[model samples]
Every structure is written in C-alpha cells, then in structure tokens.
Target: MSYPWQKLGLNADQQADSVLAAMTDGEKFAWLSGPMAIPLHKGEKIPAEAIGSAACYPSIPRLGIPAIQQSDASLGVSALGGVRPGDHATALPSSLALGAAFDPDLAETSGKLLGREAFCKGFNVQLAGGANLIREPRGGRNFEYISEDPLLTGIIAGHNVRGIQSQHVVSTVKHFALNAQETGRVVADSRLNEAALRESDLLAFELAIEIGQPGAVMPGYNLVNGEWASENPFLLSKVLKGDWQYPGWVMSDWGATHSATKAARAGLDVQSGSNLDECAWFDHPLREAVARGEIDGSYIDQMIHRILRSLFACGAIQHPAQRGTPLDYSWHQLMAQREAEQGIVLLKNAQQTLPLPPELSRLVVIGAHADQGVLAGGGSSAVTPQGCLQLEGVDFMGIQTPKVYHPSSPLAAIRRNSLAKKVDFVSGDSIEEALNSAQGCEAVIVFAQEWRSEALDAQGLDLDDHQNLLIEQLAAVHPKVIVVLQTGGAVTLPWLNKVSAVLEAWYPGSGGGEAIAGVLFGRINPAGRLPITFPASEQQLPHPKQVDPSTTTSLPGVKVKGDIFQIDYNVEGADVGYRWFERQQQKPLFPFGFGLSYTQFSYDDLQLCQSSDTVTASLTLTNCGDRSGSEVIQLYIRPTSGRYPSRLAAFRKVFLAPGESQRVSLRLEPRVIAQWETTKQLWHIVAGEYDIFQATDAATPGLCGTLTISAHAFGYRVA
Candidate 1:
C-alpha cells in the first residue's frame, strides 16, 4: 500500500500538479527568498549562523508553507527552538578525530546521537558536517575533511549518514561541488581537472549518497567552473539526480542563492539558508520577470514540487515517530567506545610492551592528558560529551570517583578500574617530572595528544616541550613505555625511536577513555589504516603550502624566515602524496595503509581474473602468529604512464583468525582501457596496459597483475 504522504502531498509524478493546485499567485511570489537582517558573527568572535537578528532575518512564514528551521553541524546538531535562536549545546570534536579512529560503527553512533538531538531540539534538518574538497592540508577547513582520499571518507561517513537518517532526521551532506580550498571558500573558483575532481572530490559525495540517501543536500557558497553551486543544474540534476537518482531536497548555502530563476532552474528546492532565506527575491525584479511570462513558471513549479516531495519522502509531514527519540546518547557512547577500541592503530609494538601482563601491581601513567580526557577534534563538529570518564588514580580508592570534569576531555575507565586497587596516577607538565615518577614502575603510558584548535591550525608537527622531551625521558625510566598519539592527522614522529610501543588513538568520541582502556589491556584488536599520507616531515609537503597552483592566498608552513606566506607550488604536478614520495624512493614516516597488529599475517596465492573492461585480483590471507587479529587489504592499481597518472584503484578491510586463512578479492574499474580526454573532457576507453597491485603498504605490492582492454568508450558522463 502507498504511504499517507503519497496522497496528502503527491507522488513524484504528480508533484508539479499538486504544487500548482496548492499555490496562488501571491503565494508563488512569497516563496522566492526573504530579506536579510543585521549582522552578528565574524572575525575575533564565535562561528555561528543564527545571531541576535544578525545577517538579515527572513520572512519565511509568509510563504503559506510553514518554514522549517535548520542549522549548521560539523559534529552534533546545535538547533535552537522557535523564532529566535536559543540555548547553546556542548560542541564535539571535528571529523579529523573520527578519521583517526577509523571505525564505521563509531561514526554511525555519533551520527545517531546528533540526529536525535536535532529532532528533540526542534530543527528540521542539519548540514551534517561537510563533504567539501580536501584540496590541500593547509586549507583552513582541512580539519573538517575526513581524509584527502575519497574512499576512506565515504565508507566512514556513509555509515554516519545512515545512522542519522535511520533515526528519521534529515542529514544534508554539504558544501556540495568542490569547495576544497577555504582561502576563497565562498568566492574561489576551484579550477581543477574534471576527472580528478570527479574521481576524488566528487567521489566522496557520490559514495555518501549511495550509502545514506540523505534527506536533503545543502549547496556550497562557491562557484564551480565559473557558476555558483546553487545555480548549477549540471551538478545537481545531471549528476546527483539523473545519474545517482538522489531523491532529496537541495538547499542553498547560507547567503549563497543569488538569483530567482537561475536557482529554481538549477534544481534548487529550498532557500532557507543565508541569502536564499533572507533576500527579498520574490518581489525583486528578477523574480517578477520570472512570474510575468519573462521566465518559465514551470521552472518555479518544478522547484516547489521538489520541496514538497522531500517533505513527504522524509515523513516530516505524516509521522513524528519516524524521526526517533533523543535518548540514544548512551547507546551512541557505547558504540563509539567499541569502534575506538577496534580501530586505534597499533603503529609500533616492540618487545610486547603492550597488553602489559596483568601481574603488574604498580602501573605509572604520565602526561597531563592521561587523567584529563581529550575526546573528539576541535571546531564546528564539536559536541560537549555529557559527564566525565573515570580514569585510573582519578578516583580515590576509598572515595567514589572524583569526576575529573573538563567539558571536552574523555577520561573514564581508569576511574572505575582503580576500585579494585590503588593505581598510581601522576601529572607532570614536564618530561623530567613525568620520567621520575615512571622510574622503577611496572609500566608507563603517555597520552601524547596534539591539539589543533580554531583561529590557527597546528603551528608545526613537533611534540610540545613536555611531550617530546617526556617521550625520551619516560621511555628510559619505564621498561614498558606505551605512547598514544591523538590528533586529526598524522604528525612526523621522531619519538618512534624511544618508545617501545606507539598507538594512533585518533579522537575516539565520547567513550574514548573506555576504548583506550580496552585496547591497552587487550580487549579488542586494532585494525585502522592511515587514510592520509604520513609525510617524512612537514617539509615533504608542497612548499608554498597550496596543493594547487590555482589558489590565491598562501597558507602557513615553512616560509622564507620573514615571509608569512606566498602563493607558489614548489612540488609542481609531479610530487603529490604517497605517490611522489613512494615512487621516488623517499621514505615516509609510515606508508598510507601501514598499521601494526598483535599477531603476524601472511599474504600468498596471488591470482588474477581479467575482463575487457575490468580486472579482479584474488589472494589468500592467513594468520601465522599466536593471536587473532584483523587487517586491511589495500589494492593500488597504477596504470603505465600513457593516459593518467598512478592512483589507488580499490581497497578492502578484512579480518582473519590465528591459524586461519581466508581468500580475498578486489575489483578494478574501467580505467584500465580508458584515457580521460583532458582537452575534449571525456572518458574514452582505449586499448591499454595496466599494472595492478595488492598489498598491505603503498611501498610494497605483495601481489602483481596485468591486463589489456579494447578501445571501449563509456555510454556517457552523467557528472
């Protein structure tokens, strides 16, 4: 049976007729755009959309259709109820932290937590984080991007989207087409090669759409190929809808919708964001032109019809329960802990420093972050984790846990575990103090958290005075030294030489403390791989700091002593990521997918299956060590330098058992026979040479396969 929304509103086919039947001439005029209000947030202050009547408040209520409120969220939903913006909620960590955790279940839990918050808080939808361009590391908004690589971003974020939408709250994957560089975010035209943008940047959005089927999508403020994103039909309709069949509403970036006719024609459905919501577009000359036979009313009807369709599809009109309750915070917390425990990459495990045998009576924990929780990344995605996590020595053995309360910290498990015995907890701001306490102790674990806050990104990649010095100091004193590095992305680590073990415990959400405890004492196996390249040093990155030569403002990095920054591309077109370094034989701190395990695994029995259009490679993976663990199988297909340069073809995350072997397979797409026509801008599959590789690291290809294909051109370029 059809749902109630089908008749109350109209089915997709009858949407245009339904909208026309419901709207009068006056109503049509009012639906265009609202007028702006006074300003509020900007430079030297907080980042927020709704302020005290700031940025031109719109008259959306006059439109006949009750306007639905929306808000920005890089992490949890921060929606204010009623006509005026209300209370402030706790902000969570950025996406950079989630990327480090590298666990999908955890990501979904976070999304679920935020979605319920939106429903309870009275917001209609949230611009769920961002799927913008990760053009360069120095890009101001890089912290929001999950990874430079698209596959990793999609797999992790897709689950999060599903979690949100599954809760019946609308999640909008945002900053739509190529808003990669932040310097010129709202204005800069991202002049990128079409295929590169399609395969890398756009690929991320496409994957999210495939996985989550978001209820709405917010257009970016920038211009792609000389046109604003909200007014680009080629991007919204041709690619997102026609090809992907995305049945969701499209809203403009706050203040981004420029024209009335053009925006409506570009497949835009809602205009409640910035200018689209506040501008008096309906009464403007351009919209009047559109209504008085100068432009097609059919276009306007199409947009309004799309909006009605979205409201109906999301069940916003028919059912309240569809959007789930807001009490799932604890559930999400548990899920996050599980993911963190699972993906915290065991980078280096020397002489069994980890899983410190339970016999150790006295354990020495150093670093200020040990007792203090540091959950999630910084900036817009930030969420205030409710209560304090219990930590070792944090609770007086005789006294109930003294909640080490910090708004953003993630300290818990230890506080509860110490109930059995009094664990020694010491906080030292310097290495000497921390080392002295660790001397003659059973084990020492240092929480080396690298914090990157707003206003300024990380100044450099070195450990701070206490962190760097303490690593060498504590390792010498404590026989078992475990180092936990937490940050958005990888930092060049020289301390690897001193520490017996190193763990990349990327910002693991609210339950980070519990996850850390579980991993430390061996509750779950670590299985995350670095999505971004871990450069040998910050110097290995492009010098001028911009990833593309097309950018304007230069970013911070090593400059000419006195020069703040200058726009220049020293790496040129050749030296790009792991490709440049690995292909050229310069060693990286760690390969792209290099993560250690508690047990050893072997890859063998390489086999290949080739088709005219694709290739499939298969290999056998067996756990040869004493313990059971999981591993991520990375497949990198580098084509012979004929058409395009080398790129990552396919990747898969796999699990295995001790003394157990499993067969694994990966599929390679049609790039094998295609030379993307750069000048003419088309993909033509030509007879080709292909070099396929399957491995655990970028530098090492455990298996090699080759294939040839006939010149087979694809049917079309939907994108």
Candidate 2:
C-alpha cells in the first residue's frame, strides 16, 4: 500500500503535509529527539554505526523517513574516526584560508570535494557554510568563517552551499545572526540595532541564502538583541523565513535550543546536536506544550513539514546512504594541496626575500614541528586527517586535544622543492639553539603557529609559545628572516619591520606542507589576500581590554552572572573591520584585501555605467612587473550622505602575465550599496553623488569616479 505522503503528490510541501497528516503525536515526538553520540573510552573508535553522523534526528519508520545523518563540515568533513581504525576524514584549508583566495570557484571546489567525501562516508546533511562576519579579530572561530566583508563572505558561502547541495547533501548556512564574538557566546545577548543588523551581519546571511539557497540553517548559541537565536522571532521567523523566503529547515547549534514552544514559534525545526540532555529540549517539552494548549498542533506540523520538505527538496530521501564506499584519498589530498597553495597570502616581500633564490646552498626552517605536519584549527570543525595522529598522541578527549596536526611533511616538501639546497629543520624549543642554528644561514624561514579553539579567544594577536622571541632572535642574526604564519585570524607582528618576508598560510589543510614548499620554491605565486585587517596592536582594536577569564562583567553594571552575558554591538554599528578602521582613521598594519605579489600590477582607465536598477564599474589592470602574478581588485562605495565610512561594494581577483592588460567589469548590486534605515524599517539608497573607489586594497584607492543617483531609491528589504 502506498503511504499517504506518496499518494498525495510529488511536490516536497505536499509530500511533507501528507506525512504530517498521518503521523501520530507520539511518533512526531520521537522524530524530534536527537540521535545518540556513542560514548567512547580513551582512544576507542567512535563506533562504525556513528560514522556518518555529527548530529542526527530520529527516523519515523511508519512514515518511511530515514534518520537525518549529519556531518560537521565547517572546513571539511568534520569527524574523529569512521568505519575503521585510522579512517579519518580529509581536512581541507580553514574557511579563512578559502576566503583569502577570494575565488568563488575554489570555494565551490572545496565544498564539492568535502560534500562528496561526506556522501561517500554516508552523510546527507553537511554543516559547512559559516558566513559570520569577523567583527572581532580575536574570535576563536574566525578561522571557521570566510571574511569580514558581507558580500565576499556571502558569495563564497553561496558557492560552497551550491557545491554541497549538488551532491544531494543539504548544506547548512549557519549561526543565524550576530555571532561575532565567542567569549560570551553561549550566554551573551548580542545587542545591536536593526539597521546595523540588516546592513552588515544579517545582510551577509541574506546574500548567501539568496545565492546558495541552502537546505538548512543552524541557529547559534548566542542571543540576537534580547532573545536567544534559537528562539528569536525577528531573525528566524520574520527575516529568514518571511523576508528571504527561505524554504529550508532550521536546526539548533549543538546545545543551542532553549525552550520548545519558543523555538518552534520562532521557526526552529530540528533540535539535532550533541549533548543528549540539551537535544531533548524539544522532545518531551514539545509534546507537553501541545497537550497543554500552550503550543498549537499546527506548529508541530510546521516543524515536521520543514524537515520533510528539505529531505525531499534536496534529494536526501531519494539518494539514500551508501555504506562502504572507499574514498580517493590521493585526489582529495591533491585538491587540499592546491587550495593551500592558492590561499596562502604573501603579506610582505621586502627586497624580494620570497621566491627564495633558486640554487640556495643553505636554508633553515624553524618551529611548529614542520618536519611532522602542519596545524589545523580546533573545536567542532576540526577533522583528524587519516594518519595525522598516532595512538600515543590521543588524549583523554578521545583524540588530539587543544591542537591537531595533519601529517603533511613541510620539511620533506621543502627538501623535494630545493634539491640543490641543504635544508636544516629546527624545533625552536630553545630560543638560544634556534638562534645559534640561524647564524650564517643564507636565509631562515620560521614556521610559527597559534592554536585557536571554539570557546576560547586568543589572548592577543601576538604569537603564543614565545614565537615572537624566536623570530626576533632569528632576525637579529640573519638579514633575511621569512616567517610562515599558521593562524586562524589576524595576529600582531611586532617584528614585522625586521622580517624580510611574511606569508599568512592560515591553518592550511592536510597537504599544507606541500603547498608551503611550492610557494617558497617559486613553483606557485601567492595570490591570497587578507580577509581581515591586521591591526598594528591590540590597543587599536575596538575592545582593547582583554577578556577577563575571572570577571563576569564586560562593562560596569552589565553583570555576567548566571548564564547571561551581554555583548553590545550598538556603538560600532555597521562599522566592522575595514569600515571601523576607516571611520576611526586608524591605520592598520596591513589592510584588508592586501597581499604582496612578486609581480606588481597597476590599475587605470576607470569607467562607470549605471542604469535605473544597477551600476557597473569597469577598469583596466596592467601587470607592470616582470613576473606574472594576480591582483584582487576591490570596489568600495562612499555615499555623500556619510552614514558611515566607505563600504566594500565589489571585488574580483584577476591574474595577468607580465605586461598583460585586461579590462575587468564588476556590477554593484543596489542592495549592497543601500543603507538599512531602522527609522523607516526599509533600505534607503541616498539620492546624491556617490564615490566609486577602484583599488588594490581597502587602504589604497588608485582610481575613483563619482556616480549620481537622480532620485532616492528605497526598498522594503534587500532582495
């Protein structure tokens, strides 16, 4: 006999409605509960049965609904162990690294590879699209996000979503809204005005959803304004579901759900996450709410409808899990290496210290156990690459704790690259020894690292574990000291002036070592740019005061007692990152979209064309230097109204051969240029002459033109 859902129609909504029509309250309640995380003894495998899942929702056998098998893929297939021993997922470059590349094509490729891996390992839902803006540089999870600019973040995340969903996997665009800081994340109320929300942070989500059309949205643990994100009506129900008209399910971040009725009312569909007790918040509570008439039965039906709709809409139901599919590790590893090579940003190349002299006789690489492997960011997004960790290194946390290193040998890769050069590796454990070894070397390249986790922010931008001292010592001895930094986000460089060259090789993935070697050996030209600003010092930051681990309050009278900490985003408003720096007139050590190429490029022949609906900026780029390289062409819009400093409107990364000239055109989406007017609850495109800045980076505007809008443009919301 055909099920009621199958009999009704083929359309996802109809199928969902039919399924909801036949389901009993008890069965629906069962569907709401989460799949269990199999407890593991120290060093024990996390059971093959739990292989494909990072978080799960129970299946309703009667309705023929399979359990939702989810995977955490912030960077790449996030898993500890899979079907067998040593079977860990492939780890790609951190999201920030991908952002640095500024290539949507690469982002999509990374997403597709990870999605394929997730599917091969039996996961239908991938939580990979993290578009949260880097409002604070020290955020523990900045590595997990794309960029500070909403447009760039959204575009990259959109491609990622498209790539993931192409494999019949549901891509989740996450942390709903305003989860900028991680210090008071779980309990903090992210207080912000609606205008700032729509113009900046929320706008990023809007664009990503508009482009990616993800199958699901995961709400963060923090609060937006006053309400918890999981139960925020304005964000989830009004903006996400109503304005954007998102046809996807909403899942709570692991342990993010607060109240059942509130969450359902606010549009949260699934409560899937870790921590059994926390995940059960929607289970028994929902049943009781429905029985007591506190919550309507329609609300429960809506929740089930959303979940079923996504499964049908995304093809998750049709493409059921396939177990025992062996992954092509070599191909995936190569892709990871390519991503690393493309994303590693060359920050400073003074006197051409990089593209190291071809036939160097002596070269010394120091710090970060580069001989063994490269580092990966910590927390839920962390993926233990196959063979990265040994049993001896596995700790009480079940695997590597605090930090995990991928088994990509940088020393071997460098040695392979420089066959003629004598490469010596130093641990840098002893500053004196490292300094001694650096003496009389042709050049010294220090592989410095700073570990970041989910719940903790960095102490400051300074490199931890005394890496600063090592760099200083090495710089003292050698004229050419190249620092290869592996960090989640921007780090202060006190010794920046002393260093000959610096490469921001953000938590490069499994094949990071090979990518580093290629860049160092001139096999690859660095094209990546800074996604976030590099402040001169911590004092220049919006919040110069360090987070007091013991203190409960951030501001006087703002008590952080109990489970509530208030984080105010009101003062800063929409000025984040470069915008903030611009408004404050504070010069950053390194500006956003800044990257040094071996070959120099020049921008000229600026042009602007505008229609009633859209505006386009076109310019010619010429490679002036001898060597071929790439340049990230950034476009910023400065309204005559002066609501805030110039905002990033558009950007394109262009590659050119020596003396090669090409005209590149970029369209400005009216929505991106418009400012959200909280007073009218609408977007206002001020009627005035606006400056269009064409530049290599945010700080440097080489070409500029003025565009005038004859009449004021207003929209209900960004479309």
Candidate 3:
C-alpha cells in the first residue's frame, strides 16, 4: 500500500492531512510524547527500541511513519555518556566560536557535518541550531548559542538549520524565546515588554525561521513574562503559529512540559523526554482530556498533521537514517580544524608579540592541561571524542557530567611548530614552581580556562585568583607573556597590561591544539571577531549581579510564588551587548567585532544608498600590511533622534592579500533600522536622518555617511 507521500504531486501539507486521517487515537497519542532514550537513574530500564541518545518517538508501521531518532547538541553529534558504547563523533568548536568567524557559509558547513554524522548514526532529528541571544555574559550555555546580536544570530543559525535539513534531518532552532541563563532556569521568569521582546530575542528567532525554515522549534524551560514558555499562548500561538505562520511542530525541552491541556492548547506539538518530568503529562492525561471533550479532537489531528508534514517535508520518512554508514573522519577533522582557526580571536597583540620567534632558545608552557588536551564545555552539548580526558565535574539531574578535554595537546602541537632549543611544560599549580621553571626562558605561554555548562552560570568573569596571580608573577619576570584562553565566553583580563598577547580560543573543538599552534606560529592568520562584548568588570553590566531566585522577593508584574522569580530584562530592553555600552556611555575592555590580525586593513570610498525600505552601504576595503589576512567590516546605524542607541546594521568578513582591494556592499536588513510598534504589531521605520558608520568594531567608527528613510511600517511575511 502506497502512502500519501508516495503519491505523485502531493505537497507536505496535503500529505500530512491524508496521513492524519489514517491514524488511530492511540497512534496519535504515541506520537505526542516519549521518554528519554537513555535511563537517567540506576535500575530504570531503557526503551526496547530506543536508539539511546536524547529521545526517540517509536515508528507507526501501519501508517508508514518512521521512528524519529534524536541526538543532543549544536557543536556535534553528542553521545550522552556514551550510550551507544564504542561510538564517537567529530566535535566542532563552540557555537560562540562559529559566531566569532562571522561566516554563515561556515555555520552551514558545520551544520552539514553534524547532520551527516547524525544521519549515518541512525538519527534523523539533530537537536541543534541554538539561536538564543547572549543576554547574560555569564550564561552557562552561551557557548551553545551564536551571538549577542539578533541579526548575526539569526543569519548564522538559519543557515545552520538549512544545512541540517538538506541532509534529510529535522533541525530545531531553539529555546523558543529568551532563555538567557541556566541558574533557576525552570523557575525564572524573563520579563520584557512586547516591543523589547519583538526587537531583540524574537527578532532573532523570526529571521532564523525565515531563512532556515526548520522542521521543529523547542521552547525553553523558563517562563516568559509570567507564563511558562511551553504553555505561553503569546509566544507559541500568537507569535510563532499566528503572525509568523510557522508550519513546523513545537517540541517541549526535556522535562519542560508543565501541563497537558494548557500546553497542547498553547501549541506544543510534542513532549520530549517525558521521563524527566514528574509524570508523563502528554500521555494518558492528554488522551483523557480529548475523550472528556476538554480539548477538541481536531486539534489533535492538527498536531499529528504538523509532525507528519515535517517528516515528509524534510525527507525523514522517505530517506530513513541508517546506522554504520561510512564517513570520512580525516576530512571532517580537517574541517573542524579550519573552523577553529577562523574563530580564534586575537584580542591583544602588544608590539607584535605573537607569531613567536622561531629561533628562541627556550620556551615554557604553563597550566590548563595544555600538555594533555584542549578544553571543551560541559553538559549536554559536550561532544566526547575518542581518547578524551575526563575530569570530575558537576552533577546535572543525577547524571555526572565530567569536564571533557579532547585529545589535542597544544604542547605537542607547539613543540612541533617551534624551533626552540628547549621546550618545557609546567602545570602552574604553584606560582613559585612555574616562575622558577620559567626563569631564563625566551618566552612564556600561559593557558587559562573557565568551564561553563548547562546547569550553572560562571561565578564571575575573572579568572581564578590563582590563575590571575600566576599570570601576574610570570609577566613581572618575563618580557613576553602570551596568554591562551579556553573559555565559554568573555572573561576579565585584570593582567591585560602585563601580558604581551592574548588569544581567545573559545573551547576550540577536536583539532583545537593544532589550530592554536598554527596561529601562534603565523602559519594561519587570525581573523575571528568578538561576537559579544568584554566589559571592564562586572560592575558595568546592566545588572551587576545575576538575580538569585532564592533571595528575590517580588517583581512588578509577576505574582510571587514559591521558588518562582522574575528577571527584569526591561532594564536593558532591546539594547544588548555593545549597544548597552553605547547607551550607558561605558567603555568595555574589548568591544564587539574587535579582533587583531597579523596584517592590517584600511577602508575608503564610503557611500550610502537608500531605497523604499532598505539602506545599502558600500566601501573599498584594502589590505595595508605585508601579509594576507581577513577583516570583519562592521556597519552600525543610529537615528539622530531616537531612544535607542546605535546597533549593528550589517557586516561582512573579507579575505585579502597584501595591498589587495575590493569594493563590498552590504544591504541592511529592514528590522535592524526599525522599531516594533506595540499597538499596531508591526515594524515601524520613523522618517528621519540616520547616521551610518563603517566600523572596525562597535566602539571604533572609521568612514561615516547619512541616509534619510521615509516613514514606513511593515509586517513580516508568514513562513
């Protein structure tokens, strides 16, 4: 018997309707919820046919529906605790690293690598494409997210989703809305006005959905305003399903579903990892609700229709995932290395301290397990490559998630690259010992790390006092002190003036050591730019301290409940990251889009053109130094009279040889220059003169121009 999808000339929607008509209530109910594929606790049995990863929806043989096999993460195909024993996957650098590259094509390529691996491993749904804006600098999962800016996050995440879907895998652009912090995530309410929400967080999701057309969306565990995101009507129904007309299904984050009836009505199509919740709310309770007439049966059919449509649309049904499919692991490793090289942002290079002199007599490497392997972020998104070094870490929901270090030794790579007569490693556990060992060394390379994960935020931006002291001591004695940072996000550099060079290698992935070594030796020119701002200190933040939910009393618009607290996002509103710095007249230690290259670049011939709804900025960019490198040209715009400060309008990363020049034009997105009109529920561009600046970073403007746009209001086209 041929299925509706098998019939000639049937679209995804029509095919879904036909398939839905053939499903029984039990079959439909089965598709609505599923348990975590891997057992979280001892004595809990794994599902018989489960693939043992994130979650799995059993197939309906009679209806010709294939099982939805899912995997964890954004960087790579994560094998949670090695559920599938002896199985390993290639690891890409952190999402923050990808964001730093400012290359959408690279993002797509990374996504394709993840998709290919997931598919070959018998999984069709790769839980990837994390587009959440980095509102909180200390956010634990910031490494998984793309950028602080909405436009950058959206474009990169959209392309990533597009790549994943191209491999017949359904990708999810997630956490639905503002899931900024991990501390008290299940209880904290992210409070923001409609206008602010639309302009910042939602805008990112909007553009991602527009570009990626992903097959699924997953809501965060937190609450938006006063309602749980999984059951928030305004978010799931109004914005996602109503105005945007997103046709894909909505899945609840693991253990995120609170209610069966409310959530279903609010537009949550699937409840994943139901075992983690107190009960399987979407199972019997949902079926009972439909039978009692509390929920219309038609809505159930609609939910089933969405799931089936996505399956047919993304080719999950037609091309079933097959295990044991061969992959070119060596080629994948090279690609991962290339991505890491592109993302290693050079934050400081005082007097050209980097590209260490090859003929040095002695060199010493200290701290951060550099002698063993490179650091990786903790928690669910962590990819454990073969030969990884596991250290004791935090316990996340009864699971012991150890801090993993991929077996790519920076010491080994550096030794191979260096022509030093003597090369040595010191653990840096003792400052005296490290200093003693570093005595008479030609140079010193200090490796510092800050490990962040899914369940907690960093204590603060500063490196540990010991590490700080170690650097200071080393700097006082040595003339050249180069620091290599392996962190989830930005960190305080108290010893900035002392250090000669600093490279922010954000949790560089599988081939990180080689990438780091390549940059240090000038074999590869660093081109990565900062995706988030690095404040001088925590005191400069909109909220100096992250609100501890336990200590909080009450919020303006929210009803105080036991354990439930509110985060006032209205303080910063739509202005986040560098924009906040601009508004507050604060100078960050390092600004967004700031990165140093081995070579220099200069801009000229700045011009601006305006159309009915968009503005285009064009300029000639030339490489002015003696070597080849890439430059991230940033365009920022601000209205002469407006409450909002300057924002990132458009950006492009160009590569050039010495003295090579190219004219580049960037067409700004309409939403970047417009504000959300709350009452009208549309983006409104006020008629005014806007100042545009060609910038090397958010804080430094080079070439400048102005453009006048006529008054216009427009709504987004429904996907």
Q: What value does the lDDT take at residue 145 in candidate 2?
A: 95
TM-score of each: 0.80, 0.94, 0.98
Misplaced by over 4 Å in model 2 are 1-9, 40-52, 60-64, 81-84, 274-279, 390-402, 547-549, 552-562, 712-719
In terms of lDDT, model 1 sits at: 0.59
Q: What is the lDDT of residue 289 in candidate 2?
A: 85
State the C-alpha lDDT per candidate.
0.59, 0.81, 0.90
Ranking the candidates on lDDT from highest down gives: 3, 2, 1
* Candidate 3 local lDDT, 494-550, one digit each (tens): 999998999999999988999999999899999999999999999999878776676
Write candidate 2's Cα lDDT for 294-374 as tens digits: 889888787778878887777777676564688888899999999998899999889887898667788888999898999
Top candidate when judged by lDDT against the true structure = 3
Lowest-sum lDDT 10-residue window in model 3: 551-560
Candidate 1 vs 2: which has more TM-score:
2
Alpha carbon deviation, residue 582, candidate 3 (Å): 0.5
